[model samples]
Target: MKTESTDANTSDQGLITLAHGAGGRVMRQLIESICVEAFNNPALALLEDQARLDMAEIAAHGDRLAFTTDSYVVDPLEFPGGDIGTLAVNGTVNDLAVSGARPLYLSCALILEEGLEISRLRRIMASMSDAAGVAGVSIVTGDTKVVPRGKGDGMFINTSGIGVIPQGVELAASRCQPGDCVIVNGTLGDHGAAILQARGDLALEADLVSDCQPLHGLIARMLAVCPQVHALRDATRGGVAGVVYEFAEASGRAIRLFEDQLPVRPSVRGVCEILGLDALHFANEGKLVAVVPREAADSMVAVMREHPAGRDACIIGEVLDGPAGSVQISTLMGGVRLLDLPIGEQLPRIC
Candidate 1:
């Protein structure tokens, strides 16, 4: 039983140094005081190179497993509504949840830049712990590395998640039928807009905050009401617009979206307008875009609205049969136009 030395300093005033990643006393102190303390769990308590789980426990849940990984490099590390830590957990959890899985475990890896503050790292770890607890998932294994100053950003997180897929639930882009309805859980582009503001480059201020949150709970509720959902995706990097184009291309169908129905917050709209950006091309963290049979659309929206994370849920569009592999938007002026995928990076380093 290896125990951390009590003489080690765990004060907030401490700053991270390259030696902390040298896999010696300093590294042990950093892990014990920050990572282990925040993500306290039986599996992680063992301190093994990998987390071990009882096969019986895993088999009892379902017959299939869903695994996914995502990396976070949002430039500001910390944002208005969430930091990289919270985004790391939720992003991984949402990846599995959207595949109709119940997230079980997560593996977190951190890349720290030299000169980073220890207190900031602790705060990030705490946020990750809270997010994991909220989603009923455990952070079981992790690794840390430190890079030279200016080499790595302040911090970057890579999270991989394992989940159990529920029986009788199947989701895929190919399952989207021509008549399927398109639904979004909430407003679009909040995360992208918030990140831009966090950078302080725009010098624009609004009441906008990143819509970063865990969506598994909200997804669970929707599944309860409509188990036959055709497809599900959390609008992240490319926003709902990107998701629409991808699905259209994959399903060999066209997507028709009503611009008037998109749930963009007033503040988010202002940010996009001033910056000459399209809200659909921006990113989001907490929003989900789902496709369901036309018959179940209303019921799904109703159930989603009951959850706090989905109060703004609405059906924004529907799948179309012709004009395959294309996305079109209906303007409020009764005109229809192509909604092309953004050419280059609208916002860089956005998770």
Candidate 2:
């Protein structure tokens, strides 16, 4: 039951507390100390309710635009390979890339529980600054809310992104055609496994780390080599299989994949085996499922592997004119299996 600052952290304001959201002294300190410092900008200087952006010109190019928003609520707030700060930045970037858009900017919203450690908050902010710097996207606007300690997680971040779709690149699952080769950007399940390992909630052990990273650069590089890329999707939640199933259903085609060609890191496989989770269905923060024309698959893959985040990229499967939206796996044991989506959360709180 921490109280909001009757006096600001500085002489100008008091320490922040839950009562800040009550529209009083506490809230002002939270805004001035945390919010104002982390997201200082001219557009946000006025502290208005709504944001007015000068992005209307990007749509006049006779190309469609893409808008997406997501919330990151992973437990522990920190993980082995990355913390939520960089994770939030890269996550939003990858979303725009997979949608065939060139990500330009992002808006961040943070929810802080009362009594949160100021040190932890500072570290998260620093990580976010570095990540945003690397991804080349600006955090133009943001909002902050404080809740009672038990009312919410220690910290929650929501990011909304906007990007301009390039002309002549219509990448959607419906555009997937038979004979299109399926390409994956890199090893799978690293992000989810890394979070779980760091938490010690799974009671299993392995040297797994999250693959969370910004993939927009890699996607841009690949597009420069070949824009005929039918579609691009980041393997986040629902993992590689989820993205493939989405394309199959959207295009009314069957996606056939081979186990041998699928990229799985040694650490990922070892962790999943101990935890009884399927690597295919686990999450990947820094990978993608790309659909390339059969003739151009090799070149695209080669280009992807040249990038650090795409070293293990592989061409794992192809689309076929079968019962649309079905994902079939050819196991290394010479048996075929259907990869139906999991009914419920097999690994809850896995990131």
lDDT (tens digit, per residue) of candidate 2 on 40-130: 6666656677666675656663377778898888887888877887888889989998877788778888888876766677678778877
What do the candidate models score in CA lDDT, each in turn? 0.90, 0.80
TM-score of each: 0.97, 0.91
C-alpha RMSD by candidate, in order: 1.4, 3.6
Model 1, which residues run further than 4 Å from truth?
A: 1-9
* Number of the top TM-score candidate: 1
Query: What tens digits encode model 1's per-residue C-alpha lDDT throughout 219-285?
Result: 9888888888989999998888889888898999999999999888899899988978999989999
